[model samples]
Target: MSMSALRRGRKAVVALTTALAVTLVSCSAGEEGAGMGEQQGTPPSTDFFGYQTNSRLVTTNAGTAFGAATNAELLASRLYPAAFVPGPGGQLIPNSDLVTTQEITEPSPDAPRKILYTISDQARFSDGEDVTCEDFLLAYKAGKMRELFGSQKPLANEISNLQCAAGFKQFVVTFNPGQGERWRYLFGPGTVMPSHAIAQKAGLTQEELVGALYAEDPYQLQEVARLWRYGFSVTEFDPDLQLSYGPFVIDRVGPDGEVILKANEDYFGDAPALEQLVVWPRSADTQRLVEDGALQVLDSSTANPTWYDRDSETNPFTLQSQPGDLTDTLVLSGYGLFSQQWARQAFAACVDQGRLAQVSSEKSGTEVAPAYVHVLRHSDPLIPRLDPVTNPHKKTDMELAGQLAGQTIRIGYLGPDERLAAMVQAIKESCEAAGVTVEDVAAEHMSQIHLEIDPETGLPTIDAFLGPVDPMYEYGGPEALIQNVSALRVAEEKLWEDLYDIPVSAQPRTFILDRSVENVVPYTGLSGIGWNMDRWNINEELAGQVTATSEETSEQ
Candidate 1:
């Protein structure tokens, strides 16, 4: 059948399902009446539904450049499992179910840099199609050509070639000379998609899609790009277009911003513990949701610590927190007043970072220390060896900031975060002493503050952003930061000189889970609790409820 025909059929099924749901509701209402009393039999089982807070009701998980961390975890990660996933204790481990061998060759005078990835034969999409080299090729093409593909990662540009056949299970990517070591980073997360699905959406065969990517056919690639960029939207979700190869596939996106995921029976790896998972959008009424038993788990990053009462017996959730990989920092913009190094340095010098850290700690209910270097983490071994003198911005220099007196510095933070607000207030107070006015422009999302350019001046709306930064992706260079302690220190020193980012305090990660959720481990990495969500199960016996059982699903 044609893709269009399949989509039409799915739409018809959805319409019929909606009509049937209404009929079921009407029938359910009459169950208390004598005539419908016989219709009632065994009570329906309460399926496992996991909840996570998303800021927006409608979001697209497509395009790695602009994908959100929440969508990456709750939706994309499980829907399209990456080759390497975040392991316990901040480690990146290969997915043994998909990847068999990964080899990297450094660039030499004799040979070009090459990275080879061999996938296991077991790797297959939810639709029973083999996860092939064509998918990786499309990923590479989309990531490399930013204008056409909407990818913003710098790692894509380092790749020179992606050598593969259409249905080959392996692909060798040759990188440009002097490029950094990026094996752990490539095809890791939010990069790979089912090429056949995209091809089907674009009204072409998988072979034709491969040819377009290799030939760089603009018109044909645009059709592919159109779907690749905007097809996986939650609001107008298409099950046929947004098929998952992982353990779970999206069942439906609810009207109230709840995303329902059902286990994929076609998955070849370990079966998911639960048959159904639901991700609820984050809202101010989170506590109410917990109390009402609607929310089972919350894998949150920016949620305020004070919102929940940990001791309350009425609430079914317990809040767990740890220091996360993302550090809350003042990210300077490279336009307007901040264009000058002195202006940037002066602003950084005036802001009391220690006080900012203290505020973050106090607000977050976590013991956060001031970070001096931008790149290195607080737990790094190299931090002790680095001279304190290397970081000169430890003390606030009012004299330096006085030079920019009467100038207004606008700062923004994504969403309404309490810690970020406190840090911004601290900055405002400290900078106010030097006659510099600090403006707080709280943004609904990251793009509003970072990417939205003012037409008149062509500068970002906010001069700096008070938020979290993943240093690895934010400050990647030709050499990997993890090469050695010395290299790490050098990178930190270079970042210090630039003043592009002023380290405030490490972000406190938080998770709220009901007692029914079992086998969950707190991870400090990017994916949070949802990293191994497939392993998580609801202990229904303990919670006095029966869980709905389903057939075995796909692997992630």
Candidate 2:
């Protein structure tokens, strides 16, 4: 999905408005025909669904957890429906499944970019409490203070006062100067804590309550920061404490490391498609469960040909892929002998990106695009141009790299994983051709390498540093590359003017799924295959056909 399509509140309103007049029709025939039905077309049972991952959701910290735990939170975000939800095409579409309507009116282009939003009268929390303007204000205030669930501290810096009118149906929020572009990030996804309840429980004065929720005072700021770090561990949900407003409530955590969520029939929107959602820690053995018919959906990361092509007659298996927002890059540190522009450029020019991508695909089971920009946004300049076939800028001279000999270049790398290691080895060989001896260093020990250059001589203590580069694709746009390069430039003030470590390609998260799964939606930054949890469903008839074939073979 494109980043522009993921803005939760505004983009959703825009997409639904445009889609209102159109109807989507499915062309599939046979048992895969559209509309939910059994045998003759009945909606699948809304009792249980199966999903598998390769890690555990141990931390509730949204900013820190980047693996399985983060995926779990995303899954929960769908079940515990937020006020706004991302749509199928990656547009933030209303969870008409939860919220009825959320309308926003902004001033004309001639006026300031401020906006006013009005909530639907039918909106209510899962607890049956009317979702008033105050609720939004409270949510915004908590989010801005970074006291709400899943809040990012950097996002809290953009919002201003969020005030609800006395009638409770109208509310207004203003943004800080220069934050107009960042409004979406500020109010994206997070839990809405009950403001009245929290204030009453804390027994604070109105002034103090405002301060705590808005963090106007240093004490309140510190307290909210503490809660932001450690709030989930507080047992028991009090009205003042954070409580989920989604379709499911956290029932009990399992000793076997499973999280059980039961449907909240009182949910304000349409009841969830499932009665229960049991999330288990991700495991490598998850494929066994699918083979045994216990799991209906498994991420492509874990699906091998053996399981993917499991006999439908007996195993009833299907396959599919979920696209994600992961990017892998080859980063060069500015500290080493590589601090020289000629040295870095020479190295970047010699490495063959096409071969590197081929090796990466073989090892990572993902299609490695040669460009540095993500495949989805082909126009974004973040992706570097590196194909020897298409790139006219590729270095054609090997003798040029020979001048940097005797200067040892250190390259940092993630691991001995397939794509990265292969790329590193290829670069090492290429450097050898140029007469430069390259040393591979662990990425963890990057800080210890002090290869500052001598300003007078314009030569580094060490030659160069190369490794895996982790860039923030979610927050920064095309300028992300420039900013990354600029930071290196600023730190190593005397280094060459040219950017070190030209980005070769983005290592994106790829999901492979059974083709039978319909309307599968994948989110960005999602690694592994289970990113689309609720959307996965099976075509039982196709499964049965596969099963039958397997049974006949077993009898023989």
Candidate 3:
């Protein structure tokens, strides 16, 4: 069927569904006291909560060409269901609702490694189309065209081919020999989107889109590329475009960066526990919003000290604070003076990572241990196997940094983050003794690294990036993934030798929950608390009790 015809039929179905819902609600109201609990549904499905985010929503579409994919991934994961999701403690768990079967075939001398995925038959798009292998194919094609899009996940380069018949639920993605060591994460959160939506937006059929993707002519895929790059990225809510197969769908978006989400009634999997979800901008008054019963969840990796200063009596909330999966590092740009390994090493020599970690821990009100490795986090099983002295930059040496005595190193970060700002201050203090000047340039996003290049210096305006780096992407090697601990050790050794990335500390973060909220599990993975937000709900009984107590106190 044509995309427009399908959409028209879908709209008719929606209208019918809405009329039936009204009838059902009317019938239920006659039998039960519907008005008694009408306003009790979490935020009434109409209310918007101001969720304070550390990073601004540059794009809701994660793992796209955008460099802020890490910042947007957590939010984007909520909208699109993936094959696998990061479970507790960073373990890769299959998202059963999306994929029914997933297995990796061992690589042979002749045959390469193959990842076979059997998508759930029940899986569908919010527009009432079946989730087919075409979607995955689109993702594979987009991943390979990184140069066209400007940025992409490292997994894109490992794929040799994607095999599947059109409309088939099962697809096999074959990797080049010795590639895809990290195959489990291929379609994990925010990496894939609905192919039908992209095709429809680009004014092409699924068959035509596939042909364009494989064609030698880049001009054929121009519209497709444009849609893939900037289609879903919206500051304002557009239900027609931002359809969801997941538990919740975007309802409204405010001018001040507030995103309101309502439960997806047509979700094939488990329904969302809460009816409405509000995502506020980073600059919102978080604590005040929490006290006013407007915000129930405050999950942040860079929350301030005031968030932790809460008494149980006055502030009834659960706080889960710990080290996160991301590493806060002072990454050097591969340009200008830092392009040379020795120059990168010299800059790293003056930066005391231990002292930086101390400042980060102190400012963030959490214990952030000094990190030395880029490929693995401190909690990884392979961490102990690696050589202890793999990174020699941990011990700051002023003499080595003196090589760049009069040169100024410009460092940038996704700003307004107090922790990163403190770390930058600490870096400036430590580097001054070596006569090296450190300039702090705060950027709205990471794309500034390539966009604002200085012509004379052959360097980005922001020479180095100071923020969190997902180690999965930072491993230094011809291959993106390492085979084992031994290979990882070698990769880490090479990483230290390159000296471009300086791992400062494992990121420390805290998730605070209001007393009236329930079923919030704190995972240290990139997704954080919102990983299972579809399951999160308002504790209606607790909320009722709190309301009653407040009324009683007022009467007294």
Candidate 4:
């Protein structure tokens, strides 16, 4: 179906749903899909259904987690922390539920920059503990310069100090000797770890945890860092240790790897309308499940549908899609032969990014464009390109990479990804011709390739891997501060290599949602679909129908 025709069809769905009142769905295992009662056609169940990506909902390892720590966790974190949450329009805003006042001062010669984050006395977690200044301090220290995990990401790094008033609600952040962008945005949507909970888990007093951050005591710091880095893992999620301050708290991690969040009745802010929010993984065909009403939001990224295949008219909902902020690229791990700048540049030049984008667009029926640099959002004036872009795919550079003949560069990718596979194959064929042997290491999933390794080798069985070339870290976010990442380079054994990203295509997040659901906002943040889930509402009667079905399903 044509794009315009599909959009017009959505008009009809909007009209039909105008009368439905706000409603939501619930889950308790064995009672999920039966939410529509005995309706022949799956009537809009009150449940507000959405989707999740690869089962990695909590791992911090970039290779296996798909960056979920920064993305998916935002949904749960938004409830407790009031500093920042992704707004409906893609900008960061203070969560009114927790934040009472947010002040951003203009930069000047005398006092360059400043941000004040003040949470409400009413702010509290699911367990009824008050949200305090110490929580934000924990996030700032643990994440700012990677003092804990021994990695260097410039997030939450700029503040010279965080001074809090006696009550601990009003916190003032003072800048260091120089102003930093990561410092600018960190306060915009700052993430806070539960200081009280972390202290309890680490067997330290609340005073000790905050004191450790202030004193930078190696002994106490290491204890806090251990939990921040590895404690909240979804693989071995400990509900008690992973307490939440959000509107919904994680009740359990399902056997199938779904993160199940139950309503946090003790929450300080307005309770979320939905009692049970289940972020489920797509088990089989996504489009079919969405068509059957088993899924409410069909993420285009996971569905991997092309433009021509993007149809919303025949369905009962409006397809709301906006450009995603991610770019497709081949990130060459600068390990072994790829460590040299010449070697990295030579192989990067040979891969036909334009051709790769074209092939992908044709396969997915979407328009694809080639990216020349890391940061491509025309919206941000930051990171102005200094060089002109030209294609090497049009002309071969066999002579350039000929220096590394007979060198085997192992390239790994998520197996069965048709689009990625195509890009990798093109890269493989091009690199191989230049005398550099390209070993394509395909894995069933990201964990298989990234987390697992041969013991004897002591190296990632592969030399290089392919994934999104994060432009933000370079000039996008904190990495923009300066390339002073030698500290980070030393932490990771294999990931230390200079990253060489060859931009392939610009892929956007697309979604098809039921008309019965409201406030469907498209966001370009880490929490892709759930960027504005807090504002999502459903139809009242439909929710009742879903509840009845659930009760019935539970009985059987």
User: Against the hidden true structure, what lDDT does model 1 obtain?
Assistant: 0.66
Ranking 1 against 3 by TM-score, winner: 3
- In model 1, how large is the Cα lDDT of residue 341? 94
For 333-391, candidate 3 gives per-residue lDDT tens digits of 67677877889988988988889889988887788788887777766666656656454
lDDT of 4 by residue, 213-272 (tens): 787777767766777666766669877666666677776655555556677777766667
User: What TM-scores do the predictions have?
Assistant: 0.79, 0.58, 0.83, 0.71
Tell me the deviation in Å of residue 302 in model 3. Answer: 5.6
- For model 1, residues 90-129, the per-residue Cα lDDT tens digits are 6677787877554566568667678778877887877888
Off by more than 4 A, model 3: 1-51, 65-70, 100-104, 108-110, 164-166, 215-217, 301-309, 389-391, 448-459, 473-483
For 1-556, candidate 2 gives per-residue lDDT tens digits of: 1111111221222223222221332434443211112233422221234455433444333332121123334444643344445555444455554334322435344432354566556555545655555445555654444322334334445555576553365566665554343343333343443444444454554445555555456465454434433454312222224345556655544433445556665555555554665555553344333332334444433224443433333333344433244444444546545555677766665666666656666665656555333212322343343122224434435676666766566655433334556667777787787777777664422321223345766644334433222233123222234454443323223221254434455453434433334545555443234333444445445444444454455446
RMSD of each: 9.7, 13.8, 10.1, 9.1
From the highest lDDT down, the ranking of the candidates is 3, 1, 4, 2
